[model samples]
Structures are given as structure tokens and as C-alpha cells.
Target: MNPKKLKVLSLVLASLLFISCDKPEKPAEKKIELPKPASMLTLVPDDTIFFAGGLEPVPLKEWTQWSITHFNLSKEMFNPQEIQKLREEAKTDGQRLALQIWEDYLATLLALDTQFASWGFAEKPQLASYAIGLAPVLLRINLQDVQRFNTKIAELEEKAKVKAKVETLGTATFRRYALNEQEPLAHLIIGVDGNDAVFMIDVGIESQQTLALALGQSKPEKSLAQGNRLKSLQENYKLLASSLVYLDHQQILTGLTTKDGNRMAKMVQQLASKLKEENKGWLNELHSEGCRKDLQTMGANWPQTVFGYTAFDVKAKPSKVDALMVVESKDKPLLEGLKSLRGFVPYYSKEAVFAPAVFSFGLGLSVENVGPFLMKQWTEITQKQYSCSFLKEMQTDLQAKNPAAVGFATSMASGVRGLSLSLLSLSLEKKEGMATPMPKELEAVVSLSAKDPAALVQTVAAMVPQLATLQIPADGTPVQLPLPMPLPFTPMAAINGSHLTVYAGAKAEQLAKEMGKMSLESSQGFLASSLDYGKYYGLIGDVVASVDKKEGQQQATPQMLSMFEAMKQAKVRVQTKLDFTERGLEMTMDMTSPE
Candidate 1:
């Protein structure tokens, strides 16, 4: 062979040898299947049940542990001796009580199972046969009660015909039956003389023969007991159904009746005609007490259902004072009377009340969690002088859905201090395409005292713009102002005297413009802003304002980058300063780009 051919052939042969010698690739292994997770039952002890004369249920932790132990024992998955020892160590009176109740419940279930088996039924059958004999007895009793109540009501109506002033208040008749003998059953006094009144009107009722029988009434025999139960059920059903109709008619009357005397009378007349067709009577008792007349008079045209009593002392004639104008419900009447009698005195202290409202608004506006972030901003904005109530309420509300209103109120007041800052934070979070970093500053401030100041700042921030926007023009001055651009960043800053110094970068203007554009497009401006900032390795600052185009629409405002852009080809030097305060911690970073 030629020398060149030999060399080329040798190279090819070496390549083939290398390829052949390479380890054969192994086939992919089959994935192992995982077992499904066991079902977990969390037994929460209901406090309400404890108050309602029942033993509290087991605690969730204890129940969980018990279940695990029980499962292990039954399945032979754990040592019985070890499980027993653990149970002994954890024994307590409460635990024992809970176990007893649980065991009783199990026994009841077992007994029910056994009863079905005695009737030639399978254990744990899906459906058990009910006693057919019990059904007819219950039905007859409920029907009888309905007839009896109706007859008694009719008799009362006939007796009251001589003295009762029958007037209709919508579909319900206010039958002012001046009883000859005062009865304790007539606990609700309507007139000035403490005349007992029975609403005598049906609200609505639900009929259950079995339930009625279970409740029990005077029984003549086994059959009589069933008959009485049926009567009671029917009576209840009639009452409930009738009462609902009356309530509905009353609501309708509210719309029809108006301040215009003729219109109000006409509405009442029309409603009376409707009631007469259905054999129902309607009347309202009038007494010279507690602005009840005013409420009735006001409600003549008002579109709401109100019931209660009112009393008012005659200013010059104390002897002729009036005491009762019973409406339909107590709460509405009382509220109205207070308004009328006290010259519209605010129901709650203004300072105390407004805080919760503000807090509610903030809550409705805020994103979940991110407490530390809020706290940091609050400290910086308030200069550690103010604290946050809203944020605290938010944290509390988050943990406990139904936190006390008093705590919420206090939080609201604190939040008011930092209203502007809080709103700015909200705006920043809501802005299109903007991302807000978790506030390290707030966590630091809250850590200082366990009281978060950021909550107040966020509250104040939210309230400032809201109040400003809601402000009526001073003395008829037309409120004309230039529309503000949506602020992607919340205006969080350290207040030094009159100056507000915020963290922002050179590209703030560009970022703001981008955010504004995103806002117009109804996009996530904040998230977009964050992404843009990230591209340039810039940190976002406070949010100023976020405004939706509509009057009541949301607005977005946020702080953009404060640092110079990172050079594409060079390392950047960054310096950061962190300050901790009573409110929260704040971090400031100064970055220099390499030339």
C-alpha cells in the first residue's frame, strides 16, 4: 500500500475503534410509584359549642396525635407499649373528657348499626328503614296546632274590635289591642301605657313533624302525641310563611309610601286593599315617646324596614311626655331616634370611627402579607416619629379573620399617621409591570419593638389621596387641577422638616413614564417597572400615586431606580446603609458604575 493511503486508512481505523469502545448507553429506569398520602383529620375545639352547654371538642394537635397513634396500633405499624407510654405521658383531664365524648359518639353509631341488624338488615347498611307508624301521628299533631293558633288569633281579633285601632303598616296590620288583663306573654309593650301587644302576625315557619314530636307537647296517648306534633309543625309552617309575606309587603310599602301626605295615604290604602284580599290586618301603634312618630313619619317614605320603640320628653310640658312608638324592629328605631333626638349626633366618636373605615379601605386595597416590607417603608417615611395601626390590624386580621374592632380602631388611628406612605405602597404594588421587593426596612423597625410602625405609614399613605380627592371645594371654589401621572412607586420617604427625601434613581423619569403608559393600557405597571429596573440592575423606590381613568378607579404610583445603570462590561461598586427604628428597618443602597 502507498504510504499516504496507509496513513489515512490507519486514521479511519482508529476512529472506528474509538466509537466501538465507547460504553453502551443504559436504558432509562422505570419511575417508582409513590403511595397516596393518608387522610388527615384536624379536630378543632369549638369554643361556641363549649358555651352552648356542650363539652369542647378535642384540640387539633391532640386529636392528630391520637389518630396517628390509633392508626399505628390497629395497623400494627408501631410498638403498642411505646404508644401506650406516650399516651400516659400526655394524659390530661381535658384529653380524657374529649376521649370520653368521642367514645360515646362511636357507641351511638354502633348501637344504630345493631338496631338495623335486628330487623334482618345488613350491618352498616347504606339506607335504614324508618318506622312507618310514626309518620301519620306526627303529621296529624302539626296540623292541629296550626288550626288552634289560627282560632285563638281570630278570637283575639274579635275581642279587640271594640278598643283596638287597626291600621296597616304595609302588609302587616298593627292591631293595638288594649288588653283588659295584662299578660306576661305580651312582653312587648307598644303604647305609652305599657299596653302589651302580640305581633299576632306570621313571619314564616318551617314544618318538620319528626322534629315537633321530638320537641314534645302534652300527650293524651301515643297517637295523640303524634297528632300534636303534626299540629305544631303545620302551625309553625303557616306562621313562617305568613310572616315572610308580611315582611315582603312592608318592604314594598316603604317604596310606595312617601313624605307627600296624599302619596303616603294612597300607598297605605293600596297596601291595605292587598292585605284585605288575603284576610290579613295591618296596624301601627303610635305613642308620644322617643321620636317614634318621627321615625314612622320618616319611614313613611324611607326604603327600609325599621322596628323599635322611641321616647321623648316634652320640653315645656314634662307631665305630657310620651314614651312609646314601637316600630317593627328595635335596632333601626333606636338608631333613628338617636339621630332625631340628638340632632344627628354621630353614632360613634368621629376619630375612633374613621380609623376603622380607613383601615377597611386599606385592607380592601392591600395585597396579602408583606408586613415587613410595609414596616420598613413606614419607619423611613415617618422618620421613626409615627407608628402604623393599619399594618398591625392587617397582620392581625390576616392571622385571625375576625379580629376585635377595638384593635382595628387603634390600628386605624396609627395608620392615619402614615396614610400617604401606606397608599403609596399600595399603589406601587398595584401598578402594572412593577415589582416591589419585600421591605427589609419594615421588618427591622417591627423587630425593634414588636409594634409595627409601617402599618400606620401605609394607612396614612392610603388616606391622604383619598381625603384629598374627597375634599369638597373650599367655599365654592372650583376644584380644577392637572391630572397626575400614575405613580408606580409609593411615596415613602424620610421626612426631614418640610422636605420629603425618597429613594429614587436617575432613570426614575423613564420608569415613571413607562409605568404611566402601562397604566393607560391597564397592564401591571408595577411588575413591568420592576422587570425594567431588574434589567438595568436598579432597585425600585417608593410609590407615589396610581390612578385609574375613572373617578373611583384605582391609581398607580411608585418610586423607580435610584442607582445608576450597571455597565454591561464592568463590575459595579455598591454601598448600602441600613437603619433600624421603632417602626421598622430601612435600607439605602448607593451604587456607582465603573467607567
Candidate 2:
């Protein structure tokens, strides 16, 4: 070869050698195979609510885009323009400097996920099953990593400014992250099995028993993984499902009989005991055998077990998302009660309720002729001991206070057939060049349908101090009445035949005057009491457009604006149904998008 050509060939060979020495970039496996031998279930404690999710063949960019679109935000990826905007919004030097700190934190998070996924986290450690289950006291999060994940974890911890301390339990060793002393002590457990599998446990307390359970030194007599009912629930979601969540209500409620059980109960009892010697048995009723049996019965009467599933079809017409919830109950009381909701479905027709609303929520409850049913259920829950004459005869409990008012409210709630609250406006709008934003006006209409309106009027009249009920009529214009709150405000209310209308707002005068215009009839014309998405989307769009016209939209960049425009063209509606079934109830929520 010529001298120049030989030199070039030598340089090329040297470059090739250097490239060979470097670690090759890996293409992440599309399938996520969970850890086995020590599977996610092995880490779960007894009587837990199990949940698991999987995202196979979906890129991070696409997942994030879906999230933004759901929130009605632009789907464009984060860019320097957003960072510049963040800096521009920083009003002080401290805030401006903190931007970089935030960037560092976010960068650290991205780096952690990338490094973990880059090392074949998804498919390297294949398990027979994967899950995330929540017990009464502890939560177990188990997943698999590459064989050499611990060394990488050590280096990352140093860079991330975290301190880790090691603790051993039998054959398993965990790295506990130390937090600030002032903060409540939380244990972060990271343990690896002999197999290339790792699972994490985040517990409020790290007692010897908890560690023993995770290390497989001891086993529970009855665990969620061993329960046939829970296994069936998990299976229900696993068939053509992307995720699964199983909840055993009866087991969870009954599982709180010991130290390793419910944390809330244990804390309450511990504090009560510490406070005084007299508090030794304040919670005796809760811990009693009868009370526990009643609790289990209550769980069976309601929803004993719940199974959930979520699936998506991106290629479907208008793209679709479907969710199903199977609520299993033996007594069928709750499902029957829920079935009574069909009468209230006709309460979302009026668009005026959402006219000036920035955000709003309304629910119409029907309790017509349900006084006996409610009293019976309450009696059953309380074991019908008439602890203190119960509510049937409240003459003893409220005799010191206003006995008549208490008695009336009880009766009124029992007789209430239809009750609805419509929250209208929630934003503070300022006039041009105003010194400060105007006082936020919270407008709402409360409607109640009772068997006897006159009795309620009499009770309400006695409750409000210095309020004259003589202004109200059987069928007349609504009148303003002084509210007994600390604020100087008077709302309007009226009793008309079987219904009562109450209009309340920050501007009492405006609300009082508008009371006659707003009526219960406005909400009673709809076919469904479910959320009114059409009106909600329209209101949201109007609010965004108004801001875009003045201060401009949050998406200032051209790319972001294009994404925002694209988001508007996709119409989405979600309808959730809790239909009563023979065994229990089937609650299904379907969300579909229209292009």
C-alpha cells in the first residue's frame, strides 16, 4: 500500500478497536417479564389488595402524550421553550435559581429510569406472575432488574445525594434509605433473591415481624395470593387485560386483629393507651368479637371483593379506553341501594348550571321512601342495641342542645327523595387594571325534595337566629334569609309544594335576586345524572380561549400550539355505569374519542 493509504487504514483499524471496547447500545425488549422464584406475590403480606399494571410495546413518549391529551394539555414533548417560560415566570432571584435545582431533580429521575431500562429491566428477569398489592399496614412493590443492577444502584445513589443503610433478614438483605430525622420514619426496602430478581417494600414501620414476612422466614395462614376468591378476581382482569386490581373487603376489615394488621387502628390504640390509663379499653368495642363479626357482615352486605380491569384500543374508531369493576357482595344491600339511582338520572339536563363554571361537580341523591331502609341498615350496623335510644328517639342526646332541630333534620334526611347541589362559578375575574382580583364567587343551588315541605320550613325557621319565615309561601317568590355563618351574607330559599330551592353565592345580593330564576326543575329534565361532559368541555374550552386571547395560552411555542389544536379536534366522553347484577354489581366506565 502507499504510505498515506497505509496510515489511513491504520487509523480506521484503531477506531474499530476502540468501538469494540465500548459497551454496545441495547434495544429495550418490548415485553415486560416480571421477576420469578421470588415473584411480586412473595413480597405481598397477608390479606392485601393486589394491583398490577403493564405497558408493553408502548414508548415513553407515547405514554406521556396520552397523559397530556387526557388533561386537555398540548401533547408536544418538553423543550427549551418551556424552560425559558419557567424562568420568565420566576418573580424572585430565589425562584430563578431554584429552576436549575428542579431541572437537576427531573434529570436525575429520567437518568434513573433510563439506566434501569437500559439494563434489560423489562425482560431479563421473567416471572410467572407480576402484581402490586396493598395490605392493611404495608405496601409491596416487586419487580425484576438485570443481574448487575446493585452495582449500578450504588453509583446512582451517590450521584443522587441519597444515603442507604443495609439490614439483613435471614437470607435477604435490604438497603434502607435514610430520610431527614424531622420527617416521619419510612423504610425503603430493596432486596434481591438468589435469582436475578429484586422487590421493594415501603412500610411505615420496620418491625421484626415485617422483615420476617418479606424474607420468607414466616408465612401467613391466609394470604391474598392463597385466597381462591382473590385468585379469581386477578384472573378476571388478566384475560385480555393490561392491568388488574383486586380488593378483599371482608378479609381486610377482619385482618386488623393484630400488630401486623391495619396501621391506622394500631396507631389509634397506641396513642390512646399512651395518653392515659383510662384509655386502656376505649376501643374495646372495635376489638370485640361481636364487632368484628358485624364488620365482616357489613363488608359482605356492601362489596366483599372488588376486581378491576383496564384495556385500550388505540386503533379503534376514535380510539377507545374501557374499564370494568366487579363488586362482589353476598347480601346484595349496597347493589340494591345503588339500583335506586335510576330515578335521579334525570338531573343533568340544564346547561345553565355550568354556564360560568371554571370547574364544577353535581350529584343528585334519591332517598324517597328510604327512611325505613336507612334506619334498618343503621340498626343492623350498630347491632340494634339502641346504644343511647338511637335516632328513633333522640330526645336524650340532643335535649341539652336544640332537640327540636336535631329531631327535624333526622326526619328530613329520612324523607328526602331527591337532593342535588349544582356548583356554578368558581373563578375570580378582575376588571381591567384592577388593583387586585375580585372576590371569588362560589355560586350553588341546593334542592331538596321532601314528603312534607312545611315541616322542614318550621325546623329551618327555628334554627336560624333572628330569621323570619313569614316571608315564605306555599307557592311564591323566593326570599333572602340571613345565614348564621360568621360572614355578613344572606342567601335565598323557598319551599314550593314538595321541593325547596336554596341559592348561595359570595355576592349574597346577586344570589338572593337570582333564586326565583333557578329551580329544581332545571336539574330534573336530564336523562342521566352522570357528569355532563358536553357542557364541561365547552366551559373548559371557553376558559382556555379567554385566557389565550388576553394573557395567551400556556402553550406559547409553535409546536405546542399545534399540539393544542390537534387536541381540540379529538372529542372524548366517559360514561361510567354501576349496573346491578345477580351476584353483585358490575361497574363499567367507557371512554371513547371521536376524531
Candidate 3:
């Protein structure tokens, strides 16, 4: 109640108010800057292909976590801790010092980009993607420690391996290495400060003038970083991915028809000839003007950029793969048919469900229709029989099997809306290495959309005899009575509703199981994807695994053989899918680990 005490209390309250009004001192905010992919564009010229992409950066800790799970990459080959221990021990030792430096440097590598650039190709090259002649391929790697990286480079010559020598290009210095002695393959330019390095293939560097320009010493008036085409393309694909790939359709097509055009023509001719021989006159007169025009029209009418992005959601329970891709459309003649063509999407068979699932694919009515339509168009243009022999056989066989239905439909294709075919290789269970290449044995299965169950059985009974393979062996063997089609699907076919199915192959047992055990209505993994791109170039449309054991032992085609070898030898299993839509053709492919 005293005046002095009241004044003191008021002063204390005022002091408390002043303290509360002053905001609590906040911790300094850390600013994080993500690397701009646009900066990579600055490294290339305006004449650069629109197809360019790179890895999106993450915080260092997140990157370490992702690499451990995604790649299982560690500092050591067998054990990360052991590798680090050895590396640390080797650092001071004379004999292991070089090895230690290598280990240290390699562990510090953060990211790298491999870019395909056509700087020296013909100005109006017809086909660019097909430009295999020569192009500058840039390999850029971001590193953490510069000194160790430099040491790693210098110690390379000590391994008694291919010698690496230093060469100067304008203001830039390159450590050159040639797998081929006559011509060095790689001319690597390092950053002056050492956290980065650029590897340019020595193939396209004719003069020092362009090399200087590319090195950012005599900087281009306009940088690729300033370019809008690639920047927009990344945005269009929503390029927030760990990695991505893009194709320059404009440059590729131009290269194919331009300076490298002849090579392209020869390749097509060779393929056509081979296909005709194998399929029995299916691709007759392939290199003719009409055929060339057809091919040209399909390729020419698409967007310049076709891109694909891949990311992993490892946090998910099953760890799903989140792969997405986009292909821009064009106004082409076949575009209408691609969009309108409809039927079944690709199916993951019952065989796929239990059979180690090698590869399975289903194509719709639109794609099957292309053969007949092309046959008609090609026949009219070339004035020759351009029909598909397989389709022809299928038509005849279907007619013989189901007279009334075949008569109504007329063509096997007309009666058929789509074809579902898959190859499953069960190498996963087999421990023994294949002595020879696995054969792509076709399990001939006939699927018809007939409503009557009895009619479908009678249809199978008739087809069993005709579809059997009659072989006059090279060794003069007796001409045995024609063997009935080798299958459990003999005598009668199973009918579930309107769908009738039959199978023929050395390993046709799976088909028999599939017919009765797996219902036709249950088609999982059936991709009803749109066919937008005119044609896919990379790894799309090649998800086939050997289905039969007998087929696995047979000789394979060179391409099939190479792929099978990779499947057997390497842990890499590449998957590719090609789809059609009214908008454009779509192509997607990525490497996956064998399950």
C-alpha cells in the first residue's frame, strides 16, 4: 500500500513487459540450394539436341541412404566397414597407398551424368538417333575430395593397365586413355579446383576451336543453361527424379535419313530380308519406295523430345518401382489407327503367377490390325503379295477348325481381336549354366472368342492335326505318321464362357495348366497403355523370357542370344514396353535387378 512499494512494483511490471515485447533470439536458418539441371544445359550449345536430362540432387544424408538401398553400393565390395578399414590402413603404406587413394576417391563420388551430343553431325541430317558414326559423349562426375581424385587419376598409369597420358586442349587439360592404341577413346578434362571432371569422347573433337568453346574458357555468347527447349522438356516430364533419359527424335530421324541414311537403309534391308526368310515371305519387298515412305511417315510425325523418368519408393512395404514416361504426339497417317485400335492389353499369365515369370506380353486389336492394313497398303503400292504368312496360316487354321465362325470372320485377324504371348525363363531355379544359348521356343496357342462351348471343342479337335509340325530330319529317318499336336490341349479344348484356348509346344504343359487352372477372366498386369509414339527405340516391347525348358536349350537368335547371355551372366534385366495411343506412340525401358 506504500507509494514507494507501488512505484517499485509498477517499474518491475514495466520491465517484465519490455522483456516480453523483445522476441526470443532465433537460431540462424540454414539455406539449402538444389543444383539446377538447367546449369547442365549451359555446357552444351544451341545446336544441341533437345533430349538432355540429369540426376536431381538430394541432401548428402538422404543420398547416402538411397544409395545403400537402391544400389546396395558400399565403400567395400563385400563389407563397407572392412573396405574402409583396409583403405585407412593402406593410406600410409607404400604398397597400398595407390589403392587407398583409389578407394578414398571412389567413395567420395557424389553423382555423374552421361550425355549424348551431336555437335558435328550434318546440318540437315535425316536421322539423328541412328547417327552412330560419331558424336561427343560427355561424362561429368561430381566429387567431394579434389586431391584424392587427382591422386586416383595419376595412379591409374601405375596399374600396368592401359596408359593414361595428359593432353592439353586450349586452356583445359585432359587425361587421355585409349582402349584402342591407334586412337584414344577418352579425353578427360578436370575442373581446376578438382571437385568435378568432364570426360569427352575423343571421337568428335576434330579441331581445338570447338573444344575451347565447350570447356567454358571462350564461353559461348548464349549458354545451354540459358536454353529454353531442354528446360521446358524437363518441366513437361515433371523431372523430379533420381535419374532420367531423353531422346532427340528430330536429330535422330534426321541422322537416320541424312549422312547416316545409307547405313540405315542397309540395316532395314538386312532386317527385312531376315524377317521374310524367318516368317516365310511376311516382309516382302521391304526396302521398296512404298515401304520407305511408310516407315518415314511414322517416324517423321512425332515430337522432338521423348523422355522417361524412374524413381524408387523404397519406403513402401513391398518397395514399389515408380517408373513413368512421356512421348509427344505428331500428325502421322498411322496415328489414327494406333489411337482407335482396341482390344486386350498385355496380360500376366497364370504361368507368370507361379513360373518365375520371365517375360509376358499382350497386344490389342489395333496392333494386330496393323498387319492386315499394312499388307493392303503395301500390296497396293508395290503391286506384290505383302500379306503376313503367320496371319495367313492362322486364318486357314481357324477356318478349318471352325467353319461357320471362320467363314463369318474370314481372316484369322478379323476373328481375333488381339494376341497375348509371353516367354518365361526359369533360370532362377536352375543352378547349372546353359551349354548353348536358350531358344525362343514359341508355344502356339489358339484363343477364340466363341460363345458355344461344344463348338470350341470341335474347333480344337480339327486344329490338333493340322498344327502339328512334320519334320523330315537331316539324318534319313523314316517318314513317321504325322504326330498329333504335342499338348495336353489335344482331343478337346476347355471353354470358360466364350473364350476357347489350345496350346502346342515342347513345354506346352504350362499352357494346359493355364487353360484349366487359370481363368481367362483373370488377366493381371494387363497394360491397357496408349500407343502414342510412332515407334519406340530403346528397350520397350522386349519383356520376353523363355517359357519352356526345351526352348531354353535350343539355339537363340543373335539378339536373343545376347540378351539371354546377359540375363544368365549379368544381374541386369532390362525391361522395355512400347505402347500406342491416338496422341502418340510411347516407349519406356529401364534396367532392373533379377528377382
Candidate 4:
């Protein structure tokens, strides 16, 4: 590997290990009131294009230890013995340097004296200037004891056979590492200011200004803390957020489009012109007045999107994490329009979601009034006669598809409220000794909800003319569907006033019948899913066995076999739920792995 690539890899590995893992909190050697993680937002420039905030403060020493332990626990998957042997056989300076860099940096990070670390990023931009533009980007890591941190950096520099050049900007002093001595297109800038370890790539001449903004020597006219946009989101989600991300689409688009003589903008304009000359005029629509207005309207309608973790519990009996993302829009008409599209899928209560299955998924799709909604949107756009060529083309395409939407609305969409699919059971038959086991059973169900059972049956009948001959009951009763071809298992379908279900395999019909009484409570979201990992592991093993039995197929490797053995002894289950509120949509997932 190139030394530069090794250097980048070392930094990335150290960062990932340092920030993502955790262990039990230890008592601080000396009591101190660490600032709230959100306080880091005060340093961010208000015009930031994108920002990701790590609001949880983690004890660096404990975190590094935990990460190492977790990696060790999963080392079999990587076959560590092989990796170590390969390291021992390394001959080149770069290869030896790579292994040394990993060890030296890992040790340095693990021994850090810092009690807790919090990080933040502002103004998302290219980290290196392999591009034509420069945008303000800043990365800050909250630190204590700058001397200890610098000492660690010194050790890394020595091991990597690279040198750091100490330099200053305004009142801030930083260490700069050139990408290469001959052609230093980008420089990695690392510095300490007050409590932050500021990092940014010096991509251009304006980098000093960017670094100054990061170091607080130069301040934004209005900092993100002053904006208080996250406050409402925090309150709305009721999360003591471990992390939050904010993207101002409007600000980002305006910056990209409105800037005069912007290199990127000019390049795009050139491309559009070339395309227009070839009679592909849609690209030109981007620079059109109508498109600009439409974009502005779009940005205004949904000015920003935010994401935050509502609940996070990694130290529990079974670690769990829950996060929420919201697309904020205050436009009454837009919000009302989305509300009308909310499907009738019911809430997936614990009891309602659980079934005899390895994996199950259910989705709520809007069925009612879709035709009229599409027609209304079409009318508005057509009546306005959008001048943008792209919009005109899209309108033409939608007009062609409008009849299909109308057909869907009148037949199936107007009647069905929700859909559910479940993998009921899967297993391998017992085999003695070395003989490969055969598939014993597999079953699944597909179901939908509706107010009128007969309507659902009629809809299916219209699609499959053969179904019209069966004397299907409106009451919940299973009816076998005739297959045009031979199959190993029987397939049956049933319809009730509330649900229509199709079952594959013999026992699946019972599950279909039960669907008649199953609650159709609103899930309050578009989709939800659950997985039983213990069962999933068994399924995977059976699949691997079957594949291995195939002629000319290679048997499972020892490492892969060992991994499956480990998985068999572990119990894990995951459930996810999503919901849309007046503000935006929020999805949460919970994973349980009890000892």
C-alpha cells in the first residue's frame, strides 16, 4: 500500500474505534463539570450546509477498551490467525508501516487521559481539495489536556515515518501534514484551541479563514446555537439526544445556485449548454426561471430535515437503540396533503407483531382517494403550465400513467387498507451421521386488509379469471386456489370483512384463518418489520447445508462453521417501527440480545 493510503487508513481506523464503542463509566479521578454536548454547536457557523452533532460525551479510555473487546469477540469472522501470519510475512516498508501504525495509534488512543470526548462537524464539504471548489468544513473533537493529545500525535507521526509542521493562524497554532512533499495539493490541519482539537483539510488559499472560524478566532454572524432550530426538534422528539443531524436544503441549494462565477455552477451550466445543443434540453431547465422558483418553493415548503436518537441503551441486558428523523415543513397545504396519504396500516403492538415466523414484514399503503389526489396534483401543475422543460416532460409522463392510477383506485386501491407478509416456518429434517438433511417444511402468508371481503375477492377474480369460478365466502373461510402447475405444497386464500389472506403450505391456512380476528390497528407509519435472529440462524445453517451438498460446491470453511456455531448459542431479536407525526416521520428499532 502507498504510505499516504496507509496514513489515511490509520486515521480512519482510529477514529472509528474511538467514537463508536462504549463501556461502563468509571469515576473521574478529579471531579469536573463537563459542558453539555450541545454546547459545541455554539462554535458552528450559521451558514453551515450540513451538520452532524455527537451530543453524547463518551469516556475515551473506557470507549477504546470496549471497542477492542468487541473487535476481539468478532475476530473469528476475520480469521485473526491468518491476519497475524500475513503481518509476520510482510516484507515491504509500507506493509510493515501499516501494521505498526495500527498498533501505535490504537495504543495511543486507549491510553488517553481524557475523561470524556464529544465531537461535531459543521458545513459539510469535501475533506480534500481534489475538486474545483472550497466550502467551509470543520471537524471538532472536545478535548482535555492538549499536551497529552499532542504527545499521542507525536508518537503516531514517528511510527508513520512522517513529520508534522507546526504553524499558526491568527492566535491559533496547528500542526500541518502535507499529502506529499513534491505536490502538496492538500494538507491535514490539526490544532488545539481551548477545549477542542480542530481538524480540517487545507484545500485552498481560503483554508486559513476556515480554520479561523473553527478555532473561534473568527465567529459566524449567527452561530447554530443562536438559531435554536434543534431546540424545537429536541423538544418534539423528547430525546436527550445522543446524536443529531441537521441539513438545510434551502441554504445548500441557494449557496450552490445563486453564487456568481462559482466553478461548480459554471461547470454545470457548461454541461447543460452542451446537452441543449444535442437537443436534450432538460438539463437547461435547471437554469430556467420557473425551475428556480419551483426549487425555491420546494426549499421553503421543507426547509430542513433533522435526525436524532430518541432512545439509546447499549449497556442494558439486551442493547437497544432508537432514532428518529423528521422532514420539517410548516406549509399547511403540504402537511394536509401528506396527511391524506397516510395509509390505514395498524399499529404493530408487541402481541400483534409476534407470530410463528423467522421474519415478518407489514406495510401500510394509502389506498383511498389516491386517484383524486393524483388528479388534483395533475390539474394544478397542468393549469399552471410549468415553463421548466423537465417539469413539462414529467407532466407528460404522469399523464400517460394517470389511467393506470385511476384503474388501481377503482378496483384494488380503494378497497385495500394494508398489506402483511410473513415467513411462517422453515426447518431441515433430521439426518443421521454425515448425510445432508433435507428441507422438512417451509410456509409463508400474504395478507391484506379491507372493509369489504367480497370486494377483495372480486378484485383478485378480475386479475385471475379462474378465481371467479370458486364459491368463495364473504365470511372468514379458507378457499384453495387451483394452481396451473404442480407444486410441492397446497396454496389457499381466504377473505373476511376485514382481511384477505393467501397461505402457502399445509399449516399456513390456520394462520390465514387467524388473520380474520387479528386486529387491524393503525401502525401509524408506512412500514414495520421484525426478525427472530435465533430462528434466522437456523434458517441460514439449513441453507448453507443444502448449498454445500450440491455437486462441485465447496464445503463451508472452518471459520464460517465456527461463526455459525457461535451464532447458534446466541439469542437475538430485532423490531423496528416507524411513524409520521404532524412535524415529520420517525422510525425506531430495538434489538435484544440477552445472556
User: What lDDT would candidate 4 get against the real structure?
Assistant: 0.56
TM-score of 1: 0.16
lDDT of each: 0.23, 0.44, 0.38, 0.56
Sort by TM-score, best first: what order?
4, 2, 3, 1
Instruction: Give per-residue CA lDDT, model 4, range 1-595, as digits (tens).
Output: 3564444434443443234322222223334445555466666666666665544453444434433332223333445464455456544333343454445444444443332221221111111111122433444655555676677567656765666677777777787655333322445566776656665555434455556766657776567678766566567667544355667777655544443334334434543444437664544455567877777677887888776556555466655545566777767664566566555453332223435467777777566656656667766666666666666787788766554457465555575667877786866765565446565666888877766757767766788887768656777667777879755566777785477877787656666775666555534446777777667765776566555444665677667766665554446566776655677555666555543
Give a tens-digit lDDT track for model 2, residues 297-355.
Answer: 66667655443335555445766666676677676665566555432321322222333
Q: Among all windows of ten consecutive residues in candidate 2, which has the lowest summed lDDT?
A: 17-26
User: What lDDT tens digits, residue by residue, belong to model 1 across residues 538-584?
Assistant: 22223212223345633332211111222111222222222222212
Clashing pairs in 2: 34-127, 368-417
Q: Which candidate would rank higher by TM-score, 3 or 4? A: 4
Best-to-worst lDDT order: 4, 2, 3, 1
Full-model lDDT, candidate 2: 0.44
TM-scores, all candidates, are 0.16, 0.52, 0.51, 0.71
Q: Candidate 1 local accuracy as lDDT?
A: 0.23
Q: How many Å off is the CA of 81 in candidate 2?
A: 19
